[model samples]
Target: MQMLIIGGSGEMGQWFATFFKNEGYDVWISGRRGRSDVAEKLGVRFTSTPEEIIPECDVVIVSVPIDITPEIIRQTAPIMKPGSLLMDLTSIKKNPVDAMIGSAPEGVELLGTHPMFGPSIPSLQGQTFILTPVENRCEKWFPIMRELLERHGAHIEIITPQEHDHIVSIVQGLTHFAYITIGATLKELDFDVQGSRRFMSPVYEIMLDFVGRILGQNPWLYAQIQMQNPEIPNVHRSFIEQCERLSKLVVENNADNFCTVMKDASVHFGDTGAALHRSDKLINAKVAEFEELLQSIGKEKGLYHIYSGKTHVGIVEKVMARSVDILESGKLVNLKIENVRLLNSDELNAWKNDNLAAKTRDISTYIPENADPDTLCHILGKISEGISCKVHDTYISPDGRRSATFRIDIRQDIDINKIQDDIERLLEGIGCILR
Candidate 1:
């Protein structure tokens, strides 16, 4: 059997293309702008005109952007052979499913799929794929598709397009809306996140990390998700109404009412203790991972500076099996290795000479909106010779301005003034401003 994926250059399209090709199907991808290199890398054929490929393909998966998916479906579905299976990998199902059902030839099978995970994931293990079968004239295709997906460790959930949209309105819509609102509020307040780290708890840090992750993604896609879903307006209205009601309780200083609201919400959630236990496990795992990373660095005999989540600098005297020995202001302290970061080692000699005293500086800067965290960290590492840089906080304004606060560790030997100047210059060269 042959499979063709439209919009093959996109992340999801490439994922499907690579998967089908690996499954020994004759796989081909068609996009407006074909990249031979990408096709070669995925071991699939590529073509600019999808129409030419439609007649030959036994299965055609439309894996384009959400907004353009229906148009693509309308154009390709009629051309597909009667025995071929037609599918779409859109996030939302209703519109695309309808388009596929309406435009496909009489005997073509139609299935609308939404794979919950993105392309960065290595495999589909533990991932959810929602399948909305619009038409299944080809009786054998649905089971075949299910088996293929399950073989690769994907869990399939069958639902109608309307049901999928309703659930996603809360699952994707409300969740993204909440985070986006928090981000906007931070931007509006001109919050100094890096400066506030000394007061942050692990839970707050996790929330901020999640916000940053969302803002780092494609804004257009997220906007489409919020705007295109017909059910989202109702969800947003309900959310806003709840927020208003909560604000009224706070404004009136009604402690009893607040308690009542909390009780009601807890009851609605239905398993507070179990939820807390699960969350605690995840938090513990994160802490363990953090400690393991620091120990690995210490094992390499790398001279490094450590920072507690409190944003305080500690002199790492030694990394032990369970804890790290540090000197904070002439006081020797043992910290759980997971609670500290061995992020900087450039001025190890200077720190040693100064009796392990490290100076902490909060440097605020602005980078291009939506810069990759890894790339930004790499650039900072290259420019700052002896200073360890950690992103204490990042926020993006509504107008697309992205700002970050970095915590830099400076040793006594390095000239603090000159280093600051060098950092400013390097940042400015990369279209970033030192604030």
Candidate 2:
């Protein structure tokens, strides 16, 4: 089988090309510049033009940004053969679906797919690929596509184009729009995140992870999603209005009104369901399990929480196993364990006095020097998105160990479990061990 990916030099294109190549398919990557250097590096073929690639491939995947998708579809539509599968990997669906439908040959199999995951370079192991079936002729290729995705460890779901966009408006469009707006606003406020890691909470750190991803993603792609989806503007406006109303209630000291508002909002979230659906429930579950193990290790060590006054800061002391090496250096150090919890001062004092092998000394606390940056970023990104952690900055110790700090205003109670996984993921990103 042969696959041709447009926008091949771009991150998502590179990922798709890599995915298919790994499965032993003959993959050709095409981009505007047609440099082909990346393809050579990956031992794949490269073409500069879609016109050159479409006629030669069985499957043509367009992995370009959403804004450019429609034009590209119009341009490539002319070359697609009657039986070839024409697929778009853009994040938004409706516009591209309309464009392809309006432009494609009668017998061409046009498919609209949004691979739920971004450029994280993860295996399909438990990832989901959403397919929006437009043309009936495309149904024949659904089996082949499903088989390919399943073989590579991906789960597949089929939905109508309208349903796909409706769901994505909430799942992708609104979420990205909110994070990008927050990240931009925060950046403008000149928050010094790097300087605050020592006193930061795990939850705030996770929000930063989410903010950073949308901030780093292609702005045009993100903007296109926010703009292309007709339902998004109203949803975004409603959220803003709700915020305004809440602020007004607080300013006016309207306790009864605020209580009513909060209660009404709670009803909307339901008793057990979160507003957002799990993107990769399987991978997230695995991450949660790993995090639980880390917490367990901390608990075993009797690591108790440290506080500044009445506020919980972090864990300072833990039950030391005789076999576990406890080093006392002033420079930053990276430590890992299976489980931990925030300890009260009394608990921390007990560990410090009894179990600690030495006086509490700081070797700057962070991840080990050997951890991978990409992994660290991924973990941090997840935390930022999954837990609403507002990461302000990242820091590196003199020894080159890394750490990040996030800030959050706790006006109301929040779930620590929702935030903890991202926190641990961020630590793992920097090769730091979490206990």
Candidate 3:
């Protein structure tokens, strides 16, 4: 299958390019700018002239900014071949869906997809994917695409384009507006953000993180999200009106009215208990990680970097609120606690096996006449990631029993004696005698 992403130079587009590539598709990327370097990094072909490439592709995905999605779809959809699929990876749906349906040829399939996630998400697993398929336009390929996404662990919701945009007005519009407003308030008040963290509670800390997260992203994309959605202005108005009411209640010190407002809002919100439980779990997880770091002082621990996917094994020298100092290879490396995860023993061994070279040791042993050395070696290999086994040599023993030398390959930076002991126990259980 050949998949072409129209805006593949962008982060989200590059993400999908890699995604389709992993799914065994030949991915081609097209960008308005000279971003062949982006394609080179993703190991996919880049086309400066998407017009020539559009007709030949089996699937064409438009992944540009939301404001320009409809424009891109109009320009690209006409050149699409009959029976091919046209999709957009944007947050908003109605405008793009309308553009695609109107511009695409009679047989070209149209699907409006809103991947309810950011480019920072590694994979589709546990992520939400919104699909808005035209009534008669997607009968042929919709089921296959839906099943494919679901099989890869995505939660799919089938909705009309109108419904998707309507719901997203609250989901993205209100949430982002609230967080961005908090940031604006801080700036206007000249609040000391870093200094305040010293006296912050867990809820405040987590809320601050949410605010920073949105503030750190592409402002243009956020601007498009806030501006392009037709329903968002209404959301903004209601949000402001409530904010003013709350402010008035606070300034006037009307305790009874404030309580009444809060209580009414809580009732309307529904299911406060579940929200509390989930929040508590999040807070507890953070506390637990902090406790682990404190206890790991002076002990060797493996920390896995989130973005780089690299593991650093070292003795913990000191732990701070947001970072840790590790004594690795006689040098102190400071890693942000938020950017890394603590790797357990098994995870550390697995990382070692994948990232490090293996050291081989030959184990010569004798077994029963009916024993198969190849099977035994495979079993030994399965016992742990620290070691893998292969039959090196085979011969007949003095008592007519089978004899074999197993080549045990050990992952670097692991305990050799421990692996040897584990292999010994398995060999003994299978009735093999050491030479």
* Local distance difference test, each candidate: 0.79, 0.67, 0.91
Residue-level lDDT of model 3, residues 254-344, one tens digit each, is: 9999999999999999999999999999999989999999999999889999989878888999999989999988999999999999998
List residue ranges in candidate 1 displaced over 4 A: 294-435
Off by over 4 Å in 3: 368-385, 397-402, 412-435
Off by over 4 Å in 2: 273-435
Clash pairs for candidate 1: none
- The full ranking of all candidates by lDDT, starting with the best, is 3, 1, 2
In terms of lDDT, the best-performing candidate is 3
Which structure is stronger by TM-score: 2 or 3? 3
Clashes of each: 0, 33, 0
- Write the number of the candidate with greater TM-score, choosing between 1 and 2: 1
User: For residues 1-435, what per-residue lDDT tens digits would candidate 1 score against the true structure?
Assistant: 888888887888898888888888998887777676788888888887778889988999988778999999999999998888998988788999889877888889888889998886779999999988864454768999999999989999999999999999999999999999999999999999767756876677777878877887888888988987899999999999999999999999998998999999999999999999988887787677666555553232222423322433445566654466666556666666544555445443334544545577777877876566556666665564456777888887677788888776766656888777777777788788666
- Summarize candidate 2's per-residue lDDT along 1-435 as a digit string, tens digits: 888888877888898888888888899988887768989987889876668768767888888877789998888887887788889998778888898898988878888998988776457888989988775768778788879888888888888888888888889877887888787777799877556545655455456666876787777777788887887888888888988999999999999999999898888768534434353454465456445434444232233222212222232233232112222232222233222233444664454444323211111225566654445444444443122224445677676657544443211123445455545554556456542
